[model samples]
Target: MAVSLTASGAAPQPDDAATELRARVERFVRTRVIPQESVLDAGGPAAGAALRELRSLARTEGLWALPLPAELGGGGLPFSVYAQLAEAEGASDHGPAALGSATLLDVTMLARHAGTRVRERYLEPLVSGEIRTCYAMTEADVPGTDPLLTGTRGGYAADGGWRITGRKWFTSGAGAADLVTVLARTSGAPGDREGLSLLLVPTDSPGFRIVRELPVLGAAGQYEIELDDVRVPGDHLIGEAGRALAVAGERLALGRTLRCLRWLGQAQRAFDLMCARAATRSGSRGALADHQLVQQHVFDALLALRTTRPLVHEAVALIAAGQDARTEVGLAKVAAARMLQQVTDSAIQVHGAAGLGPDTPLPALFRGGRAARILDGPDELHITTVARRILRDYGPQAVTPG
Candidate 1:
């Protein structure tokens, strides 16, 4: 399906096919994935089994891997089209993984930079969901958002391979990942931007170890990994040596965009829950929905969601067209993260103590909303970057007293 451009340069409305696919995804998440959240959260062999069954069902229903290429066993939808679908899947925290579409970032990066040998070994399996991969760039002592402080090193080996040593924290999905894409310094000093490079390390390699699983907001899955002189084939190097930052930028832009889309979905879910609670619950003055205070909360939540969705779609459209989207993405990332946090917090207030309990998804969504501000790139980073970029357009003296 083709997506036309509006007069304002905004994204076109979804065609009939896109709308149908989105409804199918929503139904699947609501009926199949939501019912399995308890099992998925318990984190055991049974959870894994249940998730695998869900993935199989998603595939059977033709709802798997919507963003990947058709030749790579995906639905081949463009990012502009997939943005809406992603929001639907994002309603449940486990929706993306359950539907087998969470590997888009890794898959896109590898397809662009990996050599024939590496691609032949990993790409197909990753695309087909036969194996999972993780991106390990952050370190325990340094801020991951700043690539210049990278402490990991990969030196030449006598056997023509490379010996890599580093420690990374917040490596999501590492416990179950088969391979990890590591960023290491190959020729530059500690703060030099020119000497970093990307390497593909198999989880079974000699010195690779999972130190511990690092929980975020009390949820498990992220990990702290240690690589002590792990040796990888020379051919495992991705793209040119000393160019990791450029390749990583490509992934981050799209990653942030996808994240914004997901955050909107979560915000919408929380908003729905809030309204339902307000309508059904009893308060001092009849139904909670009848209270002016309750109406204000609903109105504010609706405003945040509506304001943030278009910014996300604009960023998605730029990314899909291969245009520069740093500014738009920065705006969307911060806006969506804040929107989710606000809407979810309001939802929790509307539900009173029940929102904090295990019976509802508010607690999980609240935690995710809080983390969304800090991950990918923190709010401060994006704010600073966007401000400086915008300032460049008016020159230093153009805003004297305006």
Candidate 2:
């Protein structure tokens, strides 16, 4: 089916084929994904094994290639339909869309710009689950700040190869990746945008090092990369030099849309679990589901999900149509990330000790809650984007694109 999209994020009037395709993918995800919850919660070799198994199941079921283009063996659904499938996948804890996996945001950006050779080489394996890649751009130098201030450096080698240096950390899934997309400064003094570039570097190249895995509130963050003289073939660069920032910019626009969608899923998951737990737990006189405070949190979680889901849909529609929804994405990221955290925290509150104990998925879910803040783009960065957009054009008349 040819999927049409506009910038308004509207769902193209769905046909029977689209509905059936989505339903099939959903069933496969629920059946193959949800049952592995405990393995994912533990977050280790076992979690890796479970994910590997699910990847195969998803591939066999035609669910593995949902996000890629048909040329690369993907289902080629429109972004709108893909967003919906992502929402469903996002709900599960152990499948491809789970928090531990390659986020839709990062991969989509690469899929857009990566050369066909790169796609066949790297992207193909990733979609096929033959190899998993990670993204490493955040660093101790910037320490949660701008990439412009990033200290990682990449330069040419004597054999027309590339050598990368500098310290980087907080890279998601880096510990388990076969390769990593690393962004680094190619020119120290170049004032123009030409100074940055994206590199597709193999993780095992000599001189590359993993200092340690960062621990986020208890869950392992995968890797803290410390690079020194890590060298690779000059062709290691993913795209042209001087466009690294641009690639990242484009990535964030698509990334935030997917991130918003994921946040919606996360909020709903917390709400569902909270409601079920509240209905079963006993309080003074009856089930906690009817208790005043429990009900309040439950309603609050539901409200957050309802409030954000449509906005995400709207934003995604606009993005799919090629509308410039930078402002919308910024707004959505701030709202969705904050709301998911609140919802998950409330879920923990309602579930009592079950929420805190590793015995239940609540604790891991809570970690996923906090993780929403760091994904796509940091919440604070987008908030700053909103503020700058506002202050720079503070008027009833919308800011005209310069």
The best candidate by lDDT is 1
Instruction: Determine the C-alpha RMSD for candidate 1 after optimal superposition of all C-alphas.
Output: 1.6
List residue ranges in candidate 1 displaced over 4 A. 5-11, 396-402
In candidate 1, what are the lDDT values of residues 73-132, reduced to their tens digit? 888888888887999998988999988789999889888898999988888788788999
Residues 213-312, model 2: lDDT tens digits: 8887877655798778988776667767868887787776776777677667767777888888988888678978778988899878888877776667
Please give the range of 10 consecutive residues that has the lowest summed lDDT in model 1: 2-11
Cα-based lDDT at residue 113, candidate 1: 92
CA lDDT, every model vs. true structure? 0.91, 0.73
TM-score for each prediction? 0.97, 0.88
RMSD of each: 1.6, 3.5
What is the Å distance of residue 395 in model 1 from its true position? 2.3
Model 2 alpha-carbon drift over 4 Å, by segment: 1-14, 43-45, 97-107, 115-117, 190-194, 395-402
- The best candidate in terms of TM-score: 1
